[model samples]
Target chain A: MIHTEQLTKVYPGTDFAAVDCLDLEVGTGEIFGLLGPNGAGKTTTAGMLTTRVIPTSGRALVGGVDVAAQPALAKQVSGIVSQQNTLDRQLNVWENLYFHGRLFGMGATTSRRIADELLEQFQLEKWAQASVYALSGGMAQRLMVARAIFHRPAVLFLDEPTAGLDPQSRLALWEVLGQLNRDGQTIMLTTHYMEEADRLCHRVAIMDHGKILALDTPAALKRGIGADTIVTVRAAADPEQLAAVLARDVAGVERARVADGAVQLDVSGGQRLVQQIVLAAERAGADILDLSITEPTLETVFITLTGRELRD
Target chain B: MAASDVTGDVTTRAVPARIELQLRPVLTASYSALGALLLRDLVVLWKDKWVFVLRTVIQPFLLCFVFLYVFPKIGQGVGGGGGRRGESSFATVLVPGVVGISIMFQGVQSIALNMAQEFGFTREIEDRVQAPCPIWLVAMAKVLSGAAQGALSAVLVLPIAAVVHAAGVHAHLDLRWWIILTLVPLACIAMAGLGLVLGTSFEPRNIGLMFGFIILPITFLGGTYYGWTTLSPVRIGGFHWLQVLVLINPLMYVNEGMRAAFTSSPHMHLYVIYPVMAAFATTFLAIGLRNFRRRVLA
Candidate 1:
C-alpha cells in the first residue's frame, strides 16, 4: 500500500540526508513498524510518505499515487499521527475529528456518524465534548489517532504512537491499533519501544542514521541471532552448582553462566531443555527459586544488528 | 487482516450517498474544505467570545475616549484645539483612523499571534496542513478567517468610536452606503493579508520586535491621528515627503478608505483609495501566501 524508491530528504544546509537512499515497501493490510533510536530519521521517512515534508530527492507513492507529483491525491489515502500531539487545542475532541472528516470532503452527516463511531471505538465518547486542553496525555494521543483515521484513509502512519505513555495507556493503544489493522487498514508505526514493535507489528524495519539496518518479522529477526531460547534460573541454594549441573545434564545447553545469584543458559529447544535443567537442579540439591524460558526478543536482534541499544 | 464483506458493502453504500445528500450542490469539494477550515476558526473564536470582545473593544474604546473625549475635557492639545469646528474635524479624522487601526490590529492578533503559537514547539499547524488541500489553500484559510475577524473588529469599533467623544467633538459620519459596503471588507482583507505576511516572516521569539519596529510605526504613520491631506504641511521643500512616505504603509490606504466610507472629510481621492487598496491587498496576499508556504514547510 506504501512504496518508496530511494526516498531521500536532505534538509537545506545539511550535509546528510535525513532519509538516505531508502527503498521500502509496505504491503496492504500489514502493520509495519519502523524501529530506531532518536535521530534515526524514522519520523522523516514517515513525513515524506505523509506529504508533510518534501523529499530532497527520490520519490514516495501512497496507494500507487506519487506523493510529490500528486500530493493531494496521496494525502487522500494517507493519515498521519505525528510524533508530537497535533490535535487542535482550540477545538473539542468531537470537533477535531469532525473537522478532519470535513476537510477530506466528507458530508457533515457522514462526518458526525464516523466521528461518533471513532469516539466509541477509542472510548473517547465520554470526553467527546471536552476541550482538547482538558484531556490527559493518553486521551489526547487517542484523539489524534481518531482524527487521523476519521476520514478512513487507506494507510495510517503513526510516528511513535506510544511514546511517553504509562504501561496501561500504551497497552490500551495497542489494542486500538490491532483492531484498526484487523479492519484491513494498512498501518506503519515508528517507535523506539521494542516491546511495542514486537507485540504489534507484523514486520519491522530496524533503522539508524537514516538507513535500514534490518527488516523482518519479529520472530524471524530474533531467530536470526541463532539462539532459539534463553533460560534464566535463579537458584536459592547455589547458582554456581545449578549452572554446573545444567551445563552437564541439560541437552542442547550451548552455554551457561552464573551471575547475580542466577544461572543463565543459552539453549536450543529451551522448552524441553528447561525441564531437564529444573530436574537437574532438584537432583543437585539446589532450590529452583525462579526459572523462565524466553525466546530472544527484538531488542536482542536490534543490538546484534546495529551494535547499539534501541534507545542509544 | 480481512474486513468482512458486509462492512465493506455498508461503507461503499453509505459514504457516497451521504456526500451527495448533505454537501451543498454545485460547490466544489475544495471550496467546502476551505469553508470548513474557516468555520472551525469562527467556532473557536465564538467559544472565546467574551475574551475576543474585550480584546477587540478595549484598545479602540480607549483611543476614542482619550483623544476625542478625555483630551478635550482635560484641556489637552488635540483636535486642532481651536473651536467646535476644529474638535469636530479632528473627531472625523480620528474616528476613521481608530476604525482602521482596529481592523489592522484584529488581523494581526487573529492571524499573526495565533500563527506564532501554532508554529512554535506545539506544532498545531501540522494538523492543519494535513487537511487534504494544497498547502497554499491552508494559508489562504488563515487569511480568510483573519479577514473575517478584522471585519468584525471594524463593526465593533466603529459605533464606539463614532459616539464616545466630548460633547463638542462629534464625528460627522456620512454613512456612504456604497463605500461602507465595499471599502470596509476590502480594507479588512487587505490588512489580513498584511497580517499573514508579518506572521510568517517573524520568529515567535522576535514577535515583540514586530510590534516595536513594524506595528508601532505603521499605526503612528498610518493616518490614524490625522487625514492624509494633513501630511501635505509636513514637507521637505514642498516635496510632501511624509505624505509620499505614508503611502507605502498599507494601513494608510485602509484608513483613507475608512474615511471615504465613514465620513465626509476631504481625504485622499477615491480614485487612489480603491485601486491602491486593491494593489496592496494583492501584493500582501501574494507575498504572504509565499511566505506562509515557506514557513509551513520549514
Candidate 2:
C-alpha cells in the first residue's frame, strides 16, 4: 500500500510546484491510475513516491516505510517502471532481469527462474539473450516492466508505461498489467491515455496543473457527469441553429451546444431526443449528415470538471 | 484479489534479534548487488573484447614502440646519447610510466566517460541507482568496477611496454614481487578513484575539457617520462618546485609506485609513496562519493 500526506515537490529554478500538497492513498491490490496530460505533475508525484525525487515538503510512505526516511527499504519493497526507457543498453534482456533480481537480493536460482518466467510471460523469451539496443520500443518497454517486478515487489509504480507503444502492443501490455493486478500486486501508474485509464485502472485521479481535480472509479466518474446520455448531431445547417432547434423542441434536453461543427446535447431520454432532433432538422430543411447517442464517458466527466479536454 | 491476500502480517522475531535479522539481509543484499554490478561491467567488457584489447594495448604499445624502439633506432634516444646504458635506463623509467599512464587512462575511460553517457540525456543512471542499496554504495560499485578495469589494463599493458624496444634498449626491470603485488593494485585504485571524482564533477558536454585540462596535464607531469626524484634538478632557485608541484597529481604517485614496483630506479621513497597514494585514494573517493550522491539526488 502507498500513502502520502500533502506530498509536495518544487523543482529548482521553477516557481510552480511540480506536485502540490498531494494527499493520496492507494489500497493494496488496487490498480490505481494518476491520469493527466503532459506536465501534469503525474511523473513528479510518482517520482516522489518511488523515492527518486525527494519531496520539497510533506511525506510519503511505501509499504509502511517512510520513503524519505528509509529510501533503500522503500525501494526494496516497491518496483518502478519509469516513463523513459531506462533499460541498460550494455545488458541483454536476461542480464537486465537477473541483475535486478540480484539487486533485490534474490538467490541465483530464484533470479533465473523469475527471469525465465517473466521473459516467457512478457513474450520476450526469444530476445532474452539479445542486447537491449536491439529491441524495438514495445519489447524494451515490456522488458522494463519485467525487470521492475522481477523482485516480487509489494508496490509497483509505473510512470506512463504505455507512452510510445503501438495499439496492439499497448493492449498487450494492458493485459499484462491486469494479470498482475489480479495476482494481488498493488499497482499504480500515471498516464495521459484516457482509454487506458478507463479500461485498466480500478480507480483514477484526474490530475492537472499539480492538483487532482477528481478521483473515483471510472464508471462512477462517468456517471457523475449529471446527464443520462449525450446526443451528437452533425448537419448541413449551422451547428448553432441545430443547437437552438434542439433546445427549443427537445423536452428532456438539459443543455445544448455547438462543438467541432456539430450540435451536442445533454439529455435524459437519448432515443427520444435523437428522434426529436432529426424531425426538427428535417422540418427546418436542414440535411442531417450524422447523429449518434452516447453514454457519458470519463473524458466527458474530465471536461465537465476541468473545463478543458484531458489532452488540453 | 483481496487486500489481506497480499498484505499478510510480516513475521517478526524478538526485538534485538529482529533488528539483526533485518540488518543482515540488507548487508548481504548490498554485497551481492555490488558483485552483480561488477560482473555486469566485466561481461560488457568481455563482449567487446576486441574493443577492449585495442583500447588497452594500442596507446601503451605505441608509446613504448616510439620511445623505446623507434627513438633509439633513430638515434634520438632520451637522456642524451649516453649510449646503450642511457637508452636502457630510459626504457626502465619509461616502462613503468607507460604502465602507470595505461592504468590512469583506463580508469578515466571506463568510469568517467561511461558515467557521462549514463548521466547525460540518456538518463541511464536512473536504472543504476534503482538498485536496492544506499545511493552512495551504488557509486562505490562504479569505482570498484573501474578499479578492476584499471588493474586489468595495468596487467595487459606491462608486457607490451616491457619488450617492444629497439636492440640494446630493453627495460632493466628489477621486479620486486612484493612491490608488484602490493603497489600496483594500490596505484590502480588510486587512479580509478581519481576517475570517479572527474566523472561525477563534470557534465557530459564538459568531458572534453576534463581531458584537455586535467587528464593531459596529469599524464605529462605525472612523472611518466622522468622519475619524480629526477625532477629535483629542475629547480626554481634552490627549491625543487617542479618536483613539489607534480606531487599534487595522483598519477604522479601512481607512476612513482609503479617505478618502485617494477625497477630499482631512484624513485620517491616507498615511505612517501604508500601513505600519499592512500591519502589520494581516500581523498578522491570521499569527494567523488559526495559529488555522486548530490548528482543522483539532483
Candidate 3:
C-alpha cells in the first residue's frame, strides 16, 4: 500500500537530515508502527509520504502514485489523522463529515446518509448536532477517525495517534484502529509508546537518529534479545558502574546497561535470578534502592539495539 | 514480573486492505472539491446569517447615519457647510462611497481574519487543505467565498446608504444597471483577492500589523470618503502625486467603480477602471494562491 526508496529529507539550515535514506514498504492489511522517540524521524517519514513534507531526495509512493509528483492522487488513496485536533469548529459534528463527503465528490443526499452512518458508527450520534467544542478528547478522536475513513482510503496514516490521550481514551483509540484494520484497512502509525507498538502494530520499526535500528514483530523482537528475564535496578552509586558490576557478577547475565537513570540487565536464568541479583549487589557494595524483574518487552529490544530507552 | 505485567497486552487485529471507488479525472475531482469547499463556507455563513447581516450593515449604516442624517441635522454638513442642496449632494457621493467601503471591509473580515485563525490558532487548516483537490484550488475557494460575501454586503448596504438622510434632503441615485451588475462583482472579486493576499501575508498573532499597515492605509487613502476626481486639487505644482499614489491601492479602483455604477458622479474613466480592476484582481489572486500553497505545504 505504501513504499519508500531511500527517502531522505534534509530541512534547510539543519546540520543533519530529519529522515535519512529510509527504505520501507507497508503491505496491504497490516498495522505497521514506526516506533521511536522525539527527533527520531518518524513524523518526518509520515509527512513525506503524505506530501506535506518535500523529501530532499529519493521517492515515496502511495498505492503506486509518487507522493511528491502526484500529491492529489496520493491524497485520494490515503487518509490522514494529524497529531493535532483539526476539526472545523465552525461546523457541527455532522457537517464536518458531510462536508468531507462533499469534498470527495459525493452528492448532497449521499453525503448526508454517510454522515449519519459515520456518526452512528463512531458512537457520536448523540453529539451529531452539537458543536465540536462540546466533545471530549476521546470523542473528538473517534470522530476524526470516522471522517478519515468516510472516503474509504486505501491506507490510513496516523502520526502519534494517541500521544496526549488519557489511558481510557488511548485504549479506546487502539480498539478503534484495530477494528478498522480488521475491516480491511491498511494502517500505519508512528508512536513513542512502546506498549502501544507492542500491543497494536503487527510489525514495528524501531528508529533513532533518522534510521531504523531494528524491524520485526513484537514477539520476535523480544525473543531476539535471547533473555528470559529483564531486571531493572536503581542503585545509590553511579548507574553505569553498578551496571558494570552486575553484568560481571550475575551468572546468566547476557548484557547490562544504564537507561533512564537505572541499570538494566538481560539474563537467561529462572526464578532464582532475583535472589542472585540481590547477592551480587550486596557483594559489589551497591545499595540497590529499587529492583524489579519482568519479561522482555519491545522497550528491552530497543535498549538492546541502541543502549537507550524508547521514551528518551 | 509486576502486577501490571499480568494485564499486559491486548489481542492484535489485522485484516486485508481493500479499496474500490471509481475516481474521476483530476480536474473534474478538483472542480467539485472546489465547489464543495465554497459550499462549506456558505453553510457556515448561513448558520450565522443574522450576525453576517449585522456585520455587513453596521459600518455602512453608521457612516450614512452620521454623515447624511446627523451632520445635516446639526448644520455641520461636510463639503457644503450650509444649505440643504450642498448636504444632499454630499449624501449622494457618500452613499456609493459607503457601499464601496462595505465591500472592501467585508472581503477583508471574511477572508483574512478567518485565515488568521485557521492557519495559526488551532491548525484547523490541516483538515481543510487535506480535501481531494490541488492545494491552490483550496485557496481559490476562500477567495470565491469572500467575494460572495463582499457582493452580498454591497446589496445590503446600497439602499441603507442612499436613504438615511435628514428630512427634505434627498440624494438622487441614477442606477446604471449595466455598471452596477458588472462593476459590483468586479469590485468584490478585486477586493476579495486583496483579502487573500493580506490573509496569507499576515501571521496569526501579529494580525494587528495587517490592519495597522495594510487595512487602515487602504481605507483612508483609497478614495472611499471622496471620489477619485476630487483628489486632483491635492497636488504639488501640477504633479497630481496624491491621485497617482492612491492608484496603487486596489480599493481605489473598487470605489471608483462603485461611483460609476451608483450615481452620476464624476469618476475615473470607464476605459481605465474595468481593465485595471481586472488586472488587480488577477494579480492579487495569483499572489494569494502562491502564498497559500507555500503556507499549507510547509
Candidate 4:
C-alpha cells in the first residue's frame, strides 16, 4: 500500500537530513511498525509519506500515486494521525468525524451514518455530543483514530499512536488497532515501545539516527539473534570464578561476562547448561545467591544490533 | 514473497481504477470538499457561540457608542464643523466609517488571529489540510469564514451606530440599494483577503507585532476617520501624495464605498473604487494562498 525509495528530507536550517535515504515498503492488509527513539526521523518519515512534508530528494508512492507529484491523490488514499492532538477541541465528537468524512467527498447523510457507527464502535457513543475538551486523554486518542478512518482510506499512518496513554488505555487502543487490521485496513504506525511492536505489529523496522537498522517479524528477529536463552548467576563469592566454571564446562557457551557480582552467560542449550553449572558450582563450594533464565526478547536483539537501548 | 508480485497486482488493478476515477470532472468533488471544510470550521466555532457573538459585535458596539454618542455629548468632541448641517454632523461621518472599520477588524481578528493560533502550538490545521482537496481550498475556507464574520460585524455595527446619539446628530442612511448589496460583499471579501495574507505571513509568536506594525497603520490610514478624497489637502504641493499613498490600503475602498452607501458624503470615483478593490483582493489572495501552502508544507 506504501512504498519509498531513497526518501530523504532535509530541513532548511538543519545540517543533517531528518530522514536519510529511507527505503521502505508496507504491504496491503498488514500492520507495519516503525520503531525508533525521539529525533530518529519517525515523524519526519511519516510526514513525507503522508505528503504533509515535501521531500528534499527521492520518491514515495502511497496507494499507487506518487506523493510528490500527485499529493491530493495520495491524500485521498491515505489517512494520517499525527503525534499531537489534531482534533478540534471546540467541536463535538460526532461533528469531528462527520466533518472528516465529508472532506473526503462523502455525502452528508452517508457521512453522518458512518460517523454514528464509528462513534459506537470506538465506544464513544455517550460522548458523541460532548465537546472534545471534555474528553479524557484516551477518549481523545480514540476520537483521533476514528477521525482518521472516517474516510475509509486504504492506508493509515499513526505516529506514536499511544505515546502518553496509561497502560490500560494503551491496551484498549491496541485492541482497536487489531480490530481495524482484521477488518482489512493497511496500518503503518511509529512507536518507541518495544512491547507494543512485539505484540501488535506483524512486522517492525528498528530505526535510529535516520536509518533503518533491521526489519523483520518479531519472532524472526528474536530467532535471528541465534541465542536461545540468557542465563545470569549471582554469586556470594567472586562472580569471576562462576563465570570461569561456565566458560570451561558449557561447550555451546557463546560468551561469558561478569558484572554487578553476577555471572552472565549466553548459551544455546540454557536449561541443560544451568543444571551442569549448578552442580559444578556446588563442587567448588561457591555460593550462588540467585539465578535467572530468560528467552531472547526484542530488547536483547535491539541491544545486540545497535549497542544502545531502544528507550534511550 | 517477491517484490514483483506486489507491484504487479497493484499496477494491474489499483492504478487503472484510480485513473478512471480521475478522468471525471473534479469540480463537483472539489466543491463538496470545500463545503465540508467550511462546515467543519463553523461547527468548531459553534461550540464557542457566546464568545463568537461577543467577538463579532462587541468592538463595533463600543466604538460606535463611545466615539459617536458618548464623546460628542460629554464635550470630548469629534472635531467636525460645529453645525446641525446634514453632512457636517460628527455622527453622520463616523457611522459608516465605524461600520467599515468593524468589518475590517472582524476579518483580521477572527480569521487572521485564529489562523495564527491554529498554525501555532495546536496545529489543528493539519486535520483540515488532510482533506481530499487542493491545499489552496483549505486557505479559501479560512477566508470564507472570515468574510462571514465580517458580514455579521457589519450588520451588528450599523444599527448601533445609527441610533446611539444625542439630538441633531443625524445618521441619514441613504442605503443605496445596489451599492449596499454589491459593495458590502465585495468589501467583506477584500477584508478577508487582507486578513488571509496577514494571518499566513505572521507566526503566532509574532501576532502582537502584526497588530502593532500592520493593523494599526491600516486602521488609521484606511480612511476610517475621513474619506480618502478628504486627504488631498493634507498633501505635498498639488500632488495629493498622502491621498495616493492611502490608495494602496484595501480598507480605504471599503470605508469609502460604505460612505457612498450610508451617507451623503463625497467618495472616490466608482471607476477607481471597483478596480482597485478587485486588484487588492486578487493580489492579497494570491500571496496569501502561496504563503498558506508554504506554511502547511513546512
DockQ of 2: 0.32
Candidate 2 chain B least-lDDT 10 residues: B12-21
Candidate 3 lDDT by residue in tens digits, A95-185: 9999999999889999999999889888899999999999989888888899888888878999999988999999999999998888878
For residues A220-245, could you state the per-residue lDDT of candidate 1 as single tens digits? 88877777877889877777777778
**Pairs that clash in candidate 2:** none
Q: What TM-scores do the predictions have?
A: 0.85, 0.88, 0.95, 0.86
lDDT of each: 0.84, 0.84, 0.87, 0.82
The candidate that wins on DockQ is 3
Worst 10 residues of 3 chain A by lDDT: A269-278
Root-mean-square deviation per candidate: 5.8, 4.8, 5.6, 4.8
**Distance from true location, Cα of B197 in model 1, Å:** 1.5
Candidate 1 CAPRI level: acceptable
| Candidate 2 per-residue C-alpha lDDT over B1-298 given as tens digits, one digit per residue, 9 for 90 to 100 | 4666544432221111111213235566678778878777878889988898899999999998888888888888485678888988888899999989999998899889999889886677898887877888888888888888888888899899666888777788888999988888888788888988999999999999999999999999999999988888898789999988998888898898899899898898899999999999999999999998889884
Per-residue lDDT for B203-271 in model 4, tens only? 899999999999999989988878777777886777888888987788898999898888877888887
Model 2 vs truth, CA RMSD:
4.8
Instruction: Encode model 1's per-residue lDDT on B52-72: one tens digit a residue.
Output: 999999998998888888888
Name the lDDT of candidate 4. 0.82
Q: Model 1 chain B, poorest ten-residue lDDT window?
A: B17-26
Q: Give one clash count per candidate, in the order shown.
A: 0, 0, 0, 0
Candidate 2 matches the true fold with a TM-score of 0.88
Off by over 4 Å in 1: A229-294, B1-27, B235-241
Place model 4 in a CAPRI quality band.
acceptable
